[model samples]
Target: MSIPAFADISKSANDLLNKDFYHLSAGTIEVKSNTPNNVAFKVTGKSSHEKATSGAIEGKYADKSLGIKGRVYLLLPTCHPKKGVKLNLTFKQSAFHGRAFFDLLKGPTANVDAVIGHEGFLAGASAGYDVQKAAVTGYSAAVGYIAPQYSAAITATDNLSVFAASYHKVNSQVEAGAKATWNSKSGSAVGLEVASKYRLDPVSFAKAKINDRGVAAVSYNVLLRPGVTLGLGASFDTQKLEQATHKVGASFTFES
Candidate 1:
């Protein structure tokens, strides 16, 4: 499995379910179910002017008796030749997880990655050797620690980017975090961002962030039903002293 230069929430149900649709601009439909044998599955499709049409199917099979679990996904794009097809496979058990992944639009680029961890600490690394295959051709790794009150991580990539982030749970109602990155290859520093979230109640929360780029943003999320959620977000560009963007979206889930 090749590690992606960036993350794509659409390719995996875990990521898709975690997405904050506050700034989302597309319309999406998703269905999730489980087979009689306990194989879980999810199917999601989205449409938008910028993205056109795209869909993905993901499945997970876990054998508690065997102490192993596996997941696979296939994503289809209705437009663009390079983004038309993609596949991913992941396997996990106890302290280790492995994946064999790749994409087509580019020369045959494949990546494999592994992570070792327990409850409080984790470490992982990945590599792609062929530079001509993709602009993301390089290696990257990360290590992190988590506790009830605080968590921190450090990550670096052969692309000459290094970053560190940390978060602290100040109390039951508030949590704060910040991250900074530097790209040695670009000979410049990436923006530093500070973010925080506040729990309004058991079912609602608000989040806000400010960055070195003079951008500030905020979002609010709430549960509308047991399986439905709604979110709204807006951002302002201080440099322009104007609203940059605003969006609202909702998601629903169903399972047997």
Candidate 2:
């Protein structure tokens, strides 16, 4: 293969790093046009070596209860050596004592899910099967019992992976949770994670997590404006102090 230029190599490296490592560094811009009625349009662009852009048009029906969305993407030169599309539909309805939600996603990999819940209890199941690849990519069923003071759930996927999690409301401003997961294919012990969230006030909150791999992270979020928010996050490896990462991100929303 021919050698690549230094600038080209650097750009490609940054593109991959930003895309996979940190969204804050990806340089993404999104614009949603002000429109009337139930129809809306949005366009987004990301600066990377690949130079990717996408456009989406969505519509609401049934008194804004039903939504249909479609997206098209363009990656200069190539996107994964191929071009693809995604279409999704969301429907929500009042069910039992709470609500029911259904989502259908069609794209390179197709998936569907349904969920129903009331106040503090929710049950969900989802499946994703790729016919062209002749593989089952996703399968899981989960049920959660949540109360004002406690919550718990367990999930199993394809009978190969299992996960369990629980949370407790410590007080009005603080909550704590723990999670455990096991993957049969990896032959690893159950991964454990302990996490907590604290709300300093209505506009600011903080989160921290420590996982089985001796990796820990803390993040804080604050609202900068009515429709704008800012986040700062940092992670460190407890076993290796030198292995650490930090990220900063800002999000914006516009309404007519």
Candidate 3:
């Protein structure tokens, strides 16, 4: 097993609680296509009841060790066509991976990250430098161990003010994970979240998660066809169930 990047140290647990849940107030649609020349294209459109509709177009090309990706956002109402472009370059090898990102819209910022793994152990760090301010804005470091069926990681982020630890375990049909974080600067309460995913069948799965903030969520995903997937999810405020503030969302994706 290969260790993930610093930002992805808790990816398994985070994905179970966040990805495909899509508990937005509106709808989202995504389309993807791949070409024989190793180029991939994707378009995503989202609708919001409180704001105008928005979309983005992304393209990527990759080979054995190098990859490049670009995306342009379509801001509604008044779109600045050129300012929304973002670019990313990535390189990967058996024991090392690196990435660079450029955001043309926000401070026209650039960030870089690198990770190295060997013998199931990993170490990585990331830094973001603000081009406008000409100073290092933020940085983080992480260390972890990955195995065939389980993984553990610890990280210090926010300029070392926040520390987090996570663990994930997987079996044939069940996946479970937990994460905890504490902020040294505030010396406040620790934040905790746990999630689980269960494979209902070969084509479908269910996920559920809860946090210390009295919030809970559940989601179900099913493959309707060979290249089509559907996801439905809902979230609730356990402490204020009578407030009628719960949310439900659905998402559809197609790939070819």
Top candidate (TM-score): 3
In terms of lDDT, the best-performing candidate is: 3
Each prediction's Cα lDDT score?
0.62, 0.53, 0.82
lDDT of 3 at 35: 92
Question: lDDT per residue, candidate 2, 1-256, as tens digits?
Answer: 2222211212221221122222333244445554455445555444432444443333333333544443344434444665334455555465322222222333346666666666656677777767567676767776665554655666666643765444444577876767677877777788877777788999988877778998777666676766555555556677887643433333333333
Q: What ranges in model 2 sit over 4 Å off?
A: 1-110, 116-121, 130-138, 168-171, 243-256
Order of candidates by lDDT, top first? 3, 1, 2
Model 2: what TM-score? 0.59
- Measured against the true structure, the TM-scores of the candidates, in listed sequence, are 0.68, 0.59, 0.85
Clashes in predicted model 2:
0
Tens digit of lDDT per residue, candidate 1, span 50-166?
A: 667778999999888976677877778535443434456777667776776775545567676777667757677777644354554677777665555665666666643765444
Between 1 and 2, whose TM-score is larger?
Answer: 1
Off by over 4 Å in 1: 1-21, 49-51, 79-110, 114-124, 129-137, 168-171, 241-256
For residue 123, model 3's alpha carbon misses the true position, in angstroms, by 1.3
**lDDT of model 1 at residue 212?**
91
Over all chains combined, what TM-score does candidate 3 have? 0.85
Ranking by TM-score: 3, 1, 2
Error of 2 at 30 (Å): 6.6
